[model samples]
Target: MRRATSLLCFLIVMLCGTVAMAASPVNADGYYKGIKLCGRVKVVEHFADIKVKVVDSFPDLRVKVVSSFPDDVGEWQFVEYGEDFTVQFVESFPDIKIKYVNSFPGVE
Candidate 1:
């Protein structure tokens, strides 16, 4: 019985984590732009493809950028200026990743 209870607790926690990871709200004309770390300078890997989407889930959007040279890490913020989302900044380099998943109803 104790083992079963422990397993149930673990499963619950895992489910919660998954939900949180995918908590972005749905937007039909929404877009997300982010940079992903391909590899270190010594590794020399190409940047991941820039992803653009509309009427899709946030998880489906994977925007990344890579370069041969190293970039400084920083915080990235995305604010809904008009009808599109934009890459604001990054908190770190070689591992920069951001997701924009909502629209400002009346930002005009």
Candidate 2:
């Protein structure tokens, strides 16, 4: 009985660790300075990523990096790393979706 109980506890711990590792590292409600470009992503200017200036209202448009892109949503194109953009935190899934463009939108 003692051996069986010990084995069950060890298995439970291992299972929990696996589940935690499988989840994304991005916080659902925290500001993010950069994201790993798992898929294509639009590279914006440094200031553009800041949450205060970018997010106009509540429920800001921040996002976390997922292992795979969503089938229903669009994908980003440009390649940018580090704090090139700042993202406002959001309280939902599918944080942000964008399509690649040849030029910046609304710029002449």
Candidate 3:
């Protein structure tokens, strides 16, 4: 009986660890920066709920959007990655240009 209890405890710990890992997003700087290309083009269901995670290294950036809208609401926007970032909407809402301030990481 004691051995069975110990085995069960070990299984429980393993299961908890797996759950935690699955819940956490991967942090990769480059990956997050890459997603920046999506910018305004990405039609996120809840743009206000967007989360960006940036780390010192390119391999430590995470981005996610949590929204209460329906599952089929938002479509991920796609744009080309470049030094300068620009967002263009289909309508005549005016374009948003993001000037490339710097690229050396750690800049404000």
Q: Arrange candidates, best lDDT first.
A: 2, 1, 3
Candidate 3's displacement at residue 105, Å, is 12
lDDT for each candidate structure: 0.33, 0.38, 0.32
* Tens-digit per-residue lDDT, 1-108, candidate 1: 999999999999999988865554322223223332222312112332332222223343332233223222211122223212223232334222333333322101
Error of 1 at 61 (Å): 14
Candidate 2 deviant stretches above 4 angstroms: 25-34, 37-83, 91-108
Give each model's clash number: 8, 6, 10
- Evaluated at residue 88, the lDDT of candidate 2 is 41
Best-fitting candidate, scored by TM-score: 2
My TM-score estimates for the predictions, one after another, are 0.28, 0.33, 0.31
Error of 3 at 72 (Å): 33
Best by lDDT: 2
Q: lDDT of model 3 at residue 18? A: 75
Residue 86 lDDT, candidate 2, scale 0-100: 39
> Which of 2 and 3 is the better model by lDDT?
2
How high a TM-score does candidate 3 get?
0.31
